[model samples]
Target: MPQANVDFSLKETAPNIGGGRVSGSEKLTSSFDLVEQMHFFYVRVVRVRDLPRTRNPFVEVNIGNYKGTTKYFKMDHDPEWNQVFAFAKERIQAVTVEVTVRSKETINDEVVGKLAFDIADVPTRVPPDSPLAPQWYSLEDESGRKGGRGELMLAMWMGTQADEVFPDAWHSDAATVSGESIANTRSKVYISPRLWYLRVNIIQAQDLVPISRNRNPQVYVQAMLGNMVLRSRFSPDKNINPTWNEDLMFLVAEPFDDPLILSVVDKLGNNKEHSLGMCTIHLSKVEKRLLPIPVCANWYNLEKVAQDNQNNMEVKFASRLHLRVCLDGGYHVLDESIYYSSDFRATSKLLWPPTIGVLELGILNATGLLPMKSKDGRGTTDAYCVAKYGPKWVRTRTIVDSFAPKWNEQYTWEVYDPYTVITIGVFDNCHLQEGSDAGGSKDPRIGKVRIRLSTLNADRIYTHSYPLIVLQPNGVKKMGEIQLAVRFTCSSTWNLFQSYTHPLFPQMHYLLPLSVYQVESLRHQATQTLSLRLSRAEPPLRREVVEYMLDVGSNIWSLRRGRANLERLLATCNLLVEAWKWFDHICKWKNPISTMVVHFVYMIFVLFPNLILPLVFLMCIVYGASQYRKRPRHPAHMDTKLSLIDSAHSDELDEEFDTFPTSKNGEVLKKRYDRLRSIAGRMMTIIGDLATQAERLNSMLSWRDPRATPMFLAFCILASIGFYFIPWRLFALGVGFFAMRHPKFRISIPSLPQNFFRRLPARTESMI
Candidate 1:
């Protein structure tokens, strides 16, 4: 599929989103974003003592125009807030950083004490060195003389980002956030829990006694893991003994606390069901198999529940269920789209791959944005950005009440494969207010962009403003635009290139590939497991968000998707048609002089065939160079094509949104069936044509058609004998001359080879 790409680029240098503006003369086009280098100045406020007896004593940190306040300590003389405040050196325009201890008890909010550090006096402490120790600073009054109000313990040092505290420290870049919620804004790393594929194979059941003989029972087996459920087809024979060779798979993590529940279900009249017998299998007791080896099935005695007058249930003997269950740890569970999977590691920890490179993302800002919803009788948007690459996901602080928000934040991930994608999404922060949190409403999305690493040139910064497009029930909508600067730095070029020669997945995938049904089922299980795990993290990812990101429902048939794919196929096929038209025009001598030039060149190449390879390669080079002028700057995602849409039937749209087993009535189902048959009829013709072409080629050698085989053999024998006697160049030259003969002498009919090949016998006659 072709994307709509644009070259909306940055102004050479990194944007100064803090206190100052960058001049055009200072802009850099080098590999490095010069303005991104930072001297991270940190001020760690360990504790405070000898404070005035007042309620709510807090410390305020101010650097340049950025201000951050510590938590209030009510009625406490001494407050300890082991909090750190950091600032970007280049963005700090002030000569000194001021830390003030203020009392919130007074009506005027009186300042208790204040201290300042000159920018030149700060010590430069490199990483791997011992951290700078805190020193007691004497409280000063308005006159700059020492006072007895309070003494604050502070550690001030300028260090590079490699410092251990760089990740956890609060920076001025996100100074607009409240002090209480600052922790939620900073970058943090999260590793996904080790997940394994749990397989449950139910073979057969024996000696099942029916509770009521008068009622005919339709029996089937059902398996449940957590919330996901799977059912086997009902047995055709209504008997005590039944067999259902079926497999149900689930994604399970460590701890193994969840138990797999299996039950034999019986269907009764009036659309009712009864559990005849049930059994539980603890995951810890289930066998663990890394490979796809056959495991012996074991019988678990099922139990029947009976209730007494006291309501206590008693377990009674029932039939036995034969099952084979195992924890498969060999496969790399795919919770993401196959084309955009960030991780390629197997379930077992030992099978993890090595880190390949470093991926850095600079979230510049967003522009031309509209409020997601109305607020306070006016439209406003509190926008924040969330970027997820590999296992780590980072969320920036919400820039409240702004159409264009600038978050000069950068994040990095260890890239294991160049094929992985980084997804960045902008959303309206719904959880900021108390009411929304109580209701557990998720943030409304603004837009999302996915950048695949393979499309990027290594070691270069690509800055572009990508349009944020959202797909709605009505059609595709352009939400806004977001500017991002991305760079992918490879750790080892050899290792990165060597990965291309190796298998895309683990070797086991090629050796023993999973069935299409299993792949779909397991992918569903993987998404469920991932959503469950991510929802448990600090700032939870909602189920809808995860499903949207992973495209869980994309596999369900969509007429729009089918039409788009069909268009893509036809566009590819059009190239051949256009090429043949050009060839026909040339041979028809539409341009006599050009046709003579083509004939002259063709004669030279045919007579001296050794130059053919060179000419082909030279043309390839010329075509590549010509295309350089039309190269796309930024790799685009989410091409919005609203053609209203796809002019499909109402029933087709309903069927597209239907569940896996379908929830429609019989009438609607019949209409869908007729539509599907009509579509498949055209598809069957295409497939039959392709089959005929292949079968005709086989008939020449297989002797399936006696006349076709003899004709092909005679041509082959005559050509082979002539080639052995005459020079191949002379024969090709003679053929070229004949093809380029004057238009008056040329025959206005199809070639002999085309006529003969069209007459070749095919197997279409054997079709029903």
Candidate 2:
């Protein structure tokens, strides 16, 4: 099979090409040190030359330890094998691209020749636009002897850092901003460094240097840490003692290399700004004090930018800024609350008392979704859900050709602050075809809901459907509703701490410490098992039972369980349940509106077939243009106060409809409880009836029944072929004509096959 090759080139000014070989002891020592500063090396194998003629020749190429083979070519001397491999910089330091030629034989493959080249000689860095071109290299034999008469064309280059490669829009603070420019971000390929949040409160400035003798200084503070910069609001008309009590936060990488620079600048009348004095706070000092908690607020004197001995004496006593700063060690850059400006700390203290708990969130399913119009005029949606809690984010699989998608996925996240909110967003997956206009492309957001952990009662399971609300340019719209089950299990503070600090536990302190590949692998395995267990069980497992199994199976209870425990967990799940759910969902009829709209379109097509295509094409063009014009040109950050107020309003609505009795009248409360119980019993009866019908249908369609299996297969084949050739309008018309009529007419029309084939001999009788 042909493999995709990534091309890279080496610079002429490569480093240390002729360095002496290190001893095994030295190599081992340096290897550990080099691991910390590891970078990605992309090695591309382009082609091979001067190979000996063979019946079927193929070349196996190895970079570092990973190996790949080329397609075997019949009687070919020179074979092309374009393949790329990525390795860590530490491993590539003494890496060799080893190529071995082999001939395919009837009994066993025979080795024709072998050669290797050291890739350590390649340069580390190059300009982004100008990459090194592919070049031919002489291959060497096993003993470092130059006897092989073969050459390999190879190219290699260093991969750029994520921050440098991704566009600014990706890192922007706006959620609604179009991510078309983020196409090449490749965030999955790189792991972000551990990050910390630095909160700075600009309390006030006491006695600052005046810009002029008569004019009052409009002083504002600017805090800088590397590339991140934040500015405080200006203190107008407060020259002598400016007071602007504003808070600002900066997301910084761990091992904090740079000092936080705070500069007081005066706004001039010409719209220009002039710096008065500046102070530097080394993050190293902050790190030392953040062991237990951040350091207390203190007044620090600011140093003069340009010292004049005579003027400095006059300003020395007054040049100081009263600031309160602290390092928030637990924050992850990606998990910084979208509504961080909101006062969550104050709200937490007001709403719920302090408690320690783990929040178990089950994203069960979503229903009543609004179908998006596809290119072919079919109402369809590819829906997926993204749930984020603190630093962790979990994305469920995309359910294609579905309106009511049942994910039945569960995730758990540690909750340090009960006040913090978890945001779950459902979106329509839009694939952009090649050569399409980027600005015109749109990925429709179905809806999003945020839930605060503090609002829920501890140890109580709350499973309910929350309406998926969306805000469009016109107004707020009800997209659908998502069914979620959330339970917070309270644990003692000491126990929680012990679990976190356990020696055998994998590092859960950092947000998602596992690599992307590892996380993906675990999720895939778990999903497969869960799906399997749901299917084969005689009685379907309860949602609570499934969740409990998942919690145990996922190794979230304790990381020390390792691989054996995970495999055991996987074995307990049934796959058939998942398959059945999907099949049933797809086969069911859509909503009333969807059915009406589809039939209406079909009627138009049947009446005027030629005009239907032209009308659809024109509508698409108009819609795309309108969407392009409506796209936000600038990023807009969430309004914290508005978000909080909206959440409070939602809470009020929930309380109004809550089933629990809030009144003291025993008779009234008893009546309410009786009514609710009756409704629940009726719902259970309906569900049981539906299940019975489903089982009857399943048995009739089962392949285990010899009489039914052949008939079902024959019907399926005939239906598939008929649907392929028939126009959708004609199908819709035929179905509508029969559906609108009485059952007496429908039953009399389908007895032809049974009557005509009654005399046919059975397969068993023919064998006899």
Candidate 3:
């Protein structure tokens, strides 16, 4: 994947810290900031005019630092893209739209023409209901002059214009009372923003300054980013080096320019806490490395705060904290990979809907759920379903105290890519009262299923039962099965490519880019709509065929987690064993005659070590030529059929064995027993014959082959006899030379073993 170059100059400035002094309660509340607002905009690449002759021409558009490309249109001077790109407000403030036309070639793509435009130049004063008309702009070359490559057409807009109210209505304090105004306010609008996930892992803290000399200190970590605050569990009975491998996730709306504040504090009496030391981590410095998922794990020096009034300031206690931080781009967009393009024009001909489609999923019910254990020794469970697609999440109402729960709810989602998966999980809901400790009793996860849209046939509704599979610490088990109905409906064929402008499909019509959070909100609304629809139904859906598919005493989850490393070691060991097995099979003595001949040759070599080379040369001329001349014969009558008379009797014997334990008279039983004894004797004879034939065949095949095995054996025998006469250094040098040249004589070895071992550690992870 190509990295997008983003310009950060246009990013919105950080809000200023409040100047007024705050009370104690206000300070506590202000320490944790909630994400309140998001920004969105749209960019449409209309078309590109006349361009120089080039092969496979396409346009690459760069906004801020992110880049996207259009499909290459072969030998077309005027290519129509008509592709719309959306961005979060934070991603495009100071960024310029860099449009470059390039021709794809065998070696590298060549630039045909290039143009740039600052986002500020685009007109944003157009009415909310109307989009700015596409306008042509002159293309420029390296010198910033007209390149004569022709012009490009583009249209840009912000999400604010899509609002129903005009600019004057924004300043009004009173709520609109008209029926139409009331309906509009009740409707939902989805605005997508670029999202980043920041993960902070607190591993351990070293020597620290204790508040009390007599008492052992208990330590915990607090991390602050913007207004969000995350706290780690207190370390078990404070030692000098305390480890808390806890992960904290924070959502970032813009580039991380601020430093993450880490304060290590000591627990005091009456729920009081005192800061021991603190450290500041600047994420901007980490971002410059440009890693896909950057991780920094090291011990950072902790600095004392000026507020500390300890008189022993000269002690200079060495303090540090081990931390690991990573910034991840969540839910990669389909636009990042060309293979899964969501553009209507690119996929229309090959897809069923020939454009974007809608997915309807119905969560019907679950059956034969394993009863969750309760404190009162009662087997019961309150279960609910949570389904996620892209950023959208939907949760069904809890079914109280039922092993077989029925939801009968239906929901719809926008299907952008058919290949993407939708995850649905069932959990045991354990609600706690306010002021109750969360650690008292935790909710248990039931099982989950992931369904891919592409696997379902379009326009066809399927109501099928799927097994709920879960991986527990002990093993994997089937808690129960969920019955679901699903269907995919494509937009009308006539209006598939036309812009949607209906109020019913607000999300599709407005064409505003969405973030993960907005998508989840939309899914929640769909779930509520389904709930409402269910209430109106005459007789709601019910569960059927209560069957439990449970496989106890099997822990496939643990096996899967550690299988990668075990598989690599097993594979390498298998290869080594196979090598020795082949050697043993090829070098075995077949008969007394052959064995005696081999022993005679060895005895001659042992008697005259100086003449070992001469004997080997002579033997090769005689035996090697004879072996080469004896070409192995292929099987004759390979397709011959057995005579009916010869096999007819065996059919009767097969039937007799198939019904061996039949209830028969005494005379019949005696006859059956006698027949079985005779057959067993014959079977043993056949087995002996088979083994003998296999050994003879293997020896014959080895003798007829003109390869390294026979020569290697002869050389080993000669070297063994010669070793006693030759010096140790000379023998070692000869062996090293022979081994070094073995690759030239043998077939090429594969690197599968090397690659497997290299990637094994990454596959096996230790739980933190």
TM-score, each model? 0.72, 0.33, 0.28
RMSD of 3: 29.3
- Candidate 2 per-residue C-alpha lDDT over 412-528 given as tens digits, one digit per residue, 9 for 90 to 100: 765654434566667765532343334444456776655544334455445556666553333335677776656566576454322222221111213224343334333333333
Write down the lDDT of every candidate, Cα atoms only.
0.69, 0.49, 0.49
Please, what are the lDDT tens digits per residue for candidate 1 over residues 107-167? 8778888998897899999766898999999988767878777799999999755566776
lDDT of 3: 0.49
Best by lDDT: 1
Residue 142 alpha-carbon offset, candidate 3, angstroms: 92
Q: How close to the true structure is residue 513 of candidate 2, measured as C-alpha lDDT?
A: 43
Best by TM-score: 1
User: Compared to the true structure, candidate 1 yields what TM-score?
Assistant: 0.72
Candidate with the larger TM-score of 1 and 2: 1
Candidate 3 residues lying further than 4 Å off, grouped into runs, are: 1-194, 197-355, 375-377, 432-439, 473-476, 492-558, 561-768
All models, RMSD in angstroms: 12.2, 30.3, 29.3
Q: For model 1, what is the alpha-carbon lDDT of residue 688?
A: 45
